[model samples]
Target: MAVDLFTPLTLLLNACLAAVVARRVLGVPVGWPRTILVGLFVTFSIGSAVTSFAEMAGIVTGGRFTVSLSAAFILIGLVTAWVFVLGLVVLVVLEVLAPTGTLPSPLDLLTGWKARRRRARRYAQIMKIAVRHGLGGYLRGRRRTDPYHGTAKIARSLRAALNEGGVTFVKLGQMLSTRRDLIPAEFADQLAALQTRAEPEPWQDIKAAAEKAVGRPLDEVFAEVDPEPLAAASVAQVHAARLLDGAEVVLKVQRPRARTQVTADVEIILRLARRLERGTPWGRSLCVFELAKGFAAALDEELDYTVEQDNLRSVAATIEGIAVPEIHEELSSGTLLVMTRLPGTPVGAAGPLLAGFTAERRERIAHRLLGEVLRQLVRTGIFHADLHPGNVLVGEDGELGLLDFGSVGRLDTPTRSALGMLLLAIDGDDAIAATDALIELLDRPEGLAERELERRIGHLMARYRTGFGRGGPSGMFAELFRLVTAYGFAVPPQIAAAFRALAGLDGTLALISPDIDVVAAAREQGRALMREAVEPGAVRAWLEERLAGYLPIIQRLPRRLNHIVEDLEQGRLSINVRPLAHDGDRHFLNGLVQQIVIAVLAAAATLGAIMLITADVGPMITPDIRLLAVAGGALLLVGFVLALRSLALVFKPR
Candidate 1:
């Protein structure tokens, strides 16, 4: 049977199919604007294409051929998108060279390979350690989730493997500890103790790195330089010293092999992240690729001591009754830093000193420490990210000081306010309010099931409100993160840092004052902020700021009104309207006009068709069929199709 391929049904169907094909091309915009443009282009293009092809092929061509062609087009489009995005991201990530900071030249390719060969020796040892620790299965994609419920043991094994992997993996494990939402609770807990401390770098390597950084000899710069390190960590080591001016100070020196070691490990980890993400459902759900990228970036930032120098100088008394150490600017360099050594033991370890204090006194110190953390969060917007006990010091008088300002979390005003509201809401057990605040604090989780999340939060509140059985601050946050993650949301890195800070402080409080309520302390701090915000002086300042914003408008209002009055009096009052220039106005008007015109044309044609077919007054081309009746039937089909198309366009997604 001969088929007319240019029929409205065939043309419309072809255009719609082509549009679906075009959407998979990916360069097309993601939403309505893209959909509209693509649909319009396909509609115009397919009409002309079908007409040209049908004229050449004649009416013997049928609808089945068009359907087959459209299906093939869609298949090819999807395949093209897959290849393009994969090829693009792989090329970008492969730019990183093993054991080197930048791309190696063609001449250095063999030399680079040789260096990497040496690195592979260390890498093989690390892998051996992983295999020995029973992490080989996980790394090899032979194991994913622990179906036997031995996550705790697996977590411990992973932590041990990382600890043995040396400085880089220890840091990676520490970074992973914050992602409680992604990893199991047992894993987060086990990895939480993954310390970055390593054996001290040899005195020669430390001294040489320090001297080179400062552009001077040690004897010329200091009265005495200690050979023994006071503390040692993966990236840097600290040594107690005395300056040329009889001042006691601390020297932080970067390890000589730190950069190269970290670079090689990061490359390996990234490759592992890719493999895991590709092989396991859990890896994709956890977004390990993105997590590794963020970890690498942070490690990159911490490699330079100058960044820490700026951080230490910038960590001021943003909270009242706190003080910061004075850094020696002349002695500071990207590879070395000199600062006054504070007099105190770590707050968490000063158990003997704190034992003498009354319960009220310990409570006060706890409140102050947590208050300082919150103050940094909402007020200054910059906070010490690693808020472990070792970073906090307690003097005999019970005053506290913060140390090691290398990693910090910064929040903008909106995020800070939203986070504060979230903390307060959750503490108060207002699930709806907490849900609202969470929507504001988090980046993704859009179009979230708000009522369901609130219900889940309500259940969480019921469970945790019964006392400290549900773990302390860390437990509460871990549960909260897991809940959000179940809804397929990724926790932002800054928010993760904030949660870890609070968790570390909770651990600190437990060491000193186990009876203290961490959530209550946070609530108290939030309440204090609220009180200060509403104080008379604060209210006056706020009102002044608000009024200042309106001052320009107020000044212009009178003149504008007077001009309007004069124009009215002089008979020059006129309103210039450009309603169509506005998007909402134009869209509504255009759609309304289009629909009305379509309806009129369709009704007139349909009525005319009925009249012509019923009149039976045209010349008969055949014995059984009249040309007039055939024309009327065609007009009727066209009018009905036009009406249906107009309806479809009206309902199409905007």
Candidate 2:
């Protein structure tokens, strides 16, 4: 009735033989080096196992049952560790060797080893460049004499260096620039200077690439092709042109030989990623290899003009209050994209609009953009993940033009609902609901206990609220991102990418208009829509539907609560607490923290408040000891009231 060890041994043998067969067929390295290491490890494991079995059997026959059992346990432990180490070695060796489709010879291993060494040297060089650039930037700022001017100059230099370093560095710089909490605010501000800008490619090269893409000369398809480029970027450049029908159009042309260059860069990055994963724990936690691969794929899609054109149209169709330039379908190709020309001032120049338009108009525009973005994220579960000032243009007539949809996100319905609840709960200051919503939205959707999920979410929510209270929008978002990235929150890659894009928008908006209250605008729009959604009748109807769906769980709440209490008492629950430092006066800090905590608690009181609150919490009070918590909370409440009133006023007029 007992299982035999020989059966498991046969499976192990088969696995090893399968690997050998695969390596031979695939033409990978099968030299003495790996053979020796594997042979030694296998011998060690087998010898240990055999000796333990012999000892155990001998002790059993000798009538020493306790000694035999103890020896058996020790043997099992040693063998388990040995097998684990060998398995990891085998997997890595296979990963490297399998790619080449052949067993590696000694020369191949030596070549790979040497290449790795050279790569390490190259990384050192890159690190040196980064340090020099950083320090040089600091010195340049100091040299300017005027602090502001000096910082600006250094920022400009850093931006140039980042762009020059190539695609990966540019993307990293862009991401880091938006994370004010992760880095010093000064550095984040400076890095924000690096937008999606590159020197335009020459006209001759553009024409040749276009011809190559379309499989004909530029003259064959168009009456006039502009030689001078309208705009340029690292991947593709844009040119203005005229069609036979007198249509003013812009042609997005892929950079000459960019595909090959990108491929080479990606290869380098992949190799570097593998090295980092092998050598550094930080790299492993970051999943550098996977991140690099994802970035490469995204950049590849961006290089295909046809794909970008499709994304542009898709996003425009999904989201209201935004428009994408019409793509000229007939004239489009993989590398050549022609779109209807749009005349608009860059959103970066919104300052000019402030001088001309009334404050209400400005607020309206902000509301439209923010609301539409949130709606797209909720309703269609899709959003532009690379929204920055340069990609958003303000027309002379005030129409918003959303451009460059190469990076976009699509959330599943469940995920979208959780995100909505997260937004609503945060605004309502309902920490418990926010925590639950975030856990469902962010972590592994299934196979998680409700209590465990809630505990972690609460901890994270508390950390974020604390940060938001102390450091405001820039701080809160930055810390949230760092937390998610560091802790393996299991956020899908697209969501992570979306976070980067939102951060970019935050930085750009701040630069354009410091007075623009982003959260307030978002709140005002969400509240007006949600107020109608959760009126007395609406609330009753919604509750009925949810209660119907969750009746089974609702009925068992008492039992669940008992289990939760037990777990908490036993200290079996884990929390995701993020620690933030206090920078303001002690009394003021305490008051602000208490107020945010109260807001969080109040928001949790009812789903209606969460869905309908229209207040900006970012700037309730300046960091000062004189600011009373009660007065600050009152001001926030008043702001919420006025915002709701304003919405009512707008609705009445419409």
Candidate 3:
């Protein structure tokens, strides 16, 4: 074997540089000696791994292997050293270019670099798809030149791209479908049809996944596992199976590498979003980073199979007059879910079944479906956010079955109250109340013209009110979303999703019975809520709750008044009220003082402990000093916690 003289020299220099980079850039808690050792270890490992890979490749190809092994190792080490130096240069350049105080953390930068490389193929595909679909124009600052030119073609292309890109992109398209404010109406409408469809993985792969999840062979877990999947989507595929105990169930197996792929894609999208936010006017107006963050959070929740199982159980418990599948928790994992398979035809395929019903029977079915949706929104405040036709099933007995609880919407008390008011206002044709409620529901942006917004909302409501039977809930929701965007109001994501779901339900119901009135159904639901609110029992409970909250205040008032009266009678009370420059100044000053005290105590204790450790003394004195050092360390920890708590309280939003 021959060795190059420069190899050792270069490796030594690289190791030293790596040590410096680790301490400076990565903040590694190692002294110079330890850092040098780490650097040497890393270099050696990389060299060995690359050399072994090269030797294996050579042997596999029936080429020279043993003769070139040492040479390959040296060559690999040299390349690694060069690459490490280049990376340091790139990092420096990035730091220099990044805006002050906006540079990413070391961990984030490393992760992002890895993600960019990992998803390079996906990124290339995205760009190609975007250009093909005319989305590249937006990146180039070009608005749609012709509003009507090939709109359908562009919409179709974009939908195709989203489908091809994978689950995360499909999910992004689904979210964009609700953002009528950001995307054009035609694009939004087209993207709404972008379903999560993908070819099913092989049965063997699914079986392997199942066995891994259950820690047993497929035969032990199930008496018979179907070879064909019942349904397949980007996230998971469903297969009908019979358990060993004779329980019929469906196994929802997550797609291979779905989580890892989705995560990498999300990181790439987030990086692109950050770039757009910095570079484009459209991105700025839409807040692309915030949108990406929200989408990522939603997708993460959906990726967890356990979340879906919990959602199913919760809806089944609270919702009535609907069939939700029974989950088998014992046989479920984060990647594999087992649930009872309900027998029914998809609502989309139920046209023939619905056609045989009389007009009155169809109306009843429509009413039942609409009523259940309204109940989900009004009474329980948790509802299926994706109520598309494919997710709903109709049994032979005419029972409605709701499936796919992966994407659900939840409303807090305030949001639900606002929604109820808006629904009631719309039902009664009260434009003014509807306008007020809509505005209340929105996070109104600064510098908004309130009166103008109110007038616009009134006009919107009037148009919908006149066309109530003709437009239905779908039209009403569409116009409301349009108005919300027009006024620059940030509608909550959950609220927008709910509106989308309601619009879908409205269309579905209309197919069953054209005469079905969504407004009338909503009005009935509103009346029921009102009736519940004012019931004798409800009113008494409300009164008691209010009284309980006020009892302490009421009891303290008399004593406070007595003290005041006594002070006045004795002429001993002196009032020294002073006007504050700022309402928060007093609290700020108090917090500042507390933080300073804590910081001083912490620093003093830490310093004492450091001094004790560095100082050498006799054995008898050293034991006492060690005890003091321990006490100082404990005091320092306490001080740090108190300081952090105080700072948190001080800076937390009021």
Candidate 4:
């Protein structure tokens, strides 16, 4: 068995060496991390191969075993020297063929093209080798006999496969599901069914991590700890426990070697991303290095118990009614997090949990939940990034219990401003401003054409408007994505994940009570937001002063216009308005200008139409634009009616 394993290991090492040569020859981005990993793999492979050869020699020599360690070292040195010499010779020959400081000869181009053609032809051969080695397990159906499998079975299979592939693949699957633009409906659908249900580390590993964190044995610290975990996730798992003082608590333990695995895997991924940067335009545009760094930071924070503890406290302080379990600081660390255990049933079964409550009471609870969400997102920069039904629970007293504070989002001042503006634009149904906010929030390319972006945003709004009545929640969400995709606007992975969490909440509410009004819940949340802005004596006074500041800007508008007129009279400012010079006939010139004007007008109209389509009603909508649109429409109607009467009088019999 050892010899069998060593043969494959040796072959793999040789293959890696081959790849190193290819990378140098092609000038591809095979970075230090890949080279290091390959080096380790090759070293191990060579060692294993040598051990197997020694064993075989021993068997052939009738158990004499005369091969010394020094002899093995000499053989390895000779092999290395031969490989190096061959590589140097190849390099020298290529250098001689090309001559220094000169362009490639015609023959070189022809040969290079031929080489590329050969590579393309050999691509299939490479794949075949992978298949031969069982790397095609992904494509091969494990249960091919289950042809009549239902959706649930298929979902299970997909989830199983994803879990087996590990964290990076699982995360990639989750990200792809949100990308309705790139992925097919079926794959996306399958991915949506996947949830983080990874197996927790053994109790011993948890205890070891806890000991490392608190600087004591589990028995010394905890009076009792349930051997079984309450929840298992990709990064960490939770278990109910009690402190030595008899305080009931829960322990969140990070998996052993998770950081090491993540570091190794992410390095590989980053190296691959760098390689892609040279191969694909989109890869370069995406700034994969920055993205990888951001992702690594986010994931590392998730593994940090200290971060989660702070997040929970921040959330509890910002959001009213909802409570997060208090963290036991003495027992907490980067790996082990101990918190007061709150009793509650999962929010999914809220009906049964809150069976004693009336419909009105339930509505109030819903409003509170919605209010908490809005406050966390709008009032506080730090918001609960995960808010799925599973993450929330309803206590016996009807208090909301928020769990899993590992993942949270932070918005900078600019993102906060953009978010506020986005909400305002949405409420007023101003598609152009909404689009601008979106562009700002997404950090869209500086070179992105403003007019085109506005048009796409309008289109998104249009989809929202048209789809709401006909398609309902899912349809509306899908429509919103269609517009995003159509415009080539990519939502960052975190933002996309946040949206998915919201969608899950929506789906949960739908399942719980069909009669519940999502939009109404949203509106109540909005009112709570406006109320929060005017909270105490100081806040209210500050708001009043800010309103006064705005009033002066509005009041000074006429004076600014007067100044402009005065400046023009004094020749301080010259008005220069001239139509483009037309060399063609009068009619043709008029028609060309008309077309240009018409196009501009059409663009403006399209923008308006888009806003009207995508605007959200109720509390989520800002009153500013809605009122403006209403007032504008009334004036336009009255003006049209007056014009018609005047025209009728002018064309009268007299």
1-654 in candidate 4: lDDT tens per residue?
Answer: 999999878766775775475345323233333333444444455555655654653421454535455544544443443343333334333334532233544566777886546544444443354355343332332323322235455445555555555675466456556555444445566786667678778888877877888897889988999989998877678899988899999888888877766665555546545654555455555565566566667666776778888888877777677778888887788888889998887776666666677766666666667666766666676677666678787777767778888777666656666766666666556888888888887777545677876776676555554234443554455555665655667776555554555555665555334556776566456545655654697487887888988997889999999999999899898767655555556656765565565445545554554554355542211212243443333333333333322322222221
Candidate 4 Cα misplacement greater than 4 A, ranges: 1-161, 175-188, 272-293, 349-351, 354-356, 443-478, 488-498, 511-513, 527-654
lDDT scores for all predictions? 0.75, 0.62, 0.74, 0.61
Q: How high a TM-score does candidate 1 get?
A: 0.67
Q: Candidate 2 — what's its lDDT? A: 0.62
Worst 10 residues of 2 by lDDT: 618-627
Mind giving the per-residue lDDT tens digits that candidate 2 earns over 1-654?
A: 135888766655655654464334223344434444454455446656655654554433354443436544543444443453353346344444453234556676767986656656655655566466663422222232332345655666666666666755676566557444334455566676665667777778878888887788877777887787777877788888888888888888888877866665666667666766555554565566776676678667777777777777778678776777888887788888888877776676666765576666665666667777777766677788877777887766767777777777778868777777777776676767876776777775445555654555566566654334444555566666555444446667656555566565665555445567776665565565556555799789878999899999889999999988998999987776534444456655665565565445445433344333343343322222112332343444434433322222222211
- Candidate with best lDDT: 1
Better model by lDDT: candidate 1 vs candidate 2: 1
Model 4 residue 568 distance off true place after TM-score fit, in angstroms: 20
lDDT of 3 by residue, 1-654 (tens): 236868887788877877786556432233455456556656666655655655553421354444345544444544454444434333333334542245545566767886656678778778887887667775554553443367788788888888877789998999989877666777888888888878899888888888888778878778988889989998899999998889898899998788998998998889878877777776777789999999999899888999998888888888988888998888898889988888887778888987777888778877888888877787688899888778888877778888899988888767777787877777777777877787777765778887887777777766765445445776667777777787777778888877888988976887777777666666787777757766899899989999999999999999999999999999988978676557698777776787687667656766765665455542321213333443444444444444343333333333
Across 1-654, the per-residue lDDT of candidate 1 in tens digits comes to: 236645766656654654454334322223333343445455555444545544453321454333345433443343333333333222223322221134445566756888878778876887799899987776677776742278878888998998888888988998888888778888888888888878888899899999998898998989998899989988899999999889999998889889988988998888789877888767776677888998888888888877887777667635466555678889887778898988888876898998888888888888888888888887677888887888888788878888888887888878887887876776788999888888788855667787898999989887877554567878888988989988767777888888888888877877667778776677778877756666899889988999999999999999999999999999999998875788998888888897898888889889988987887677754344455765676676556645654554454435
Looking at model 4, residue 607 earns an lDDT score of: 58
Task: Score candidate 3 by TM-score against the native.
Answer: 0.70
Q: How do the candidates rank by TM-score, highest first?
A: 3, 1, 2, 4
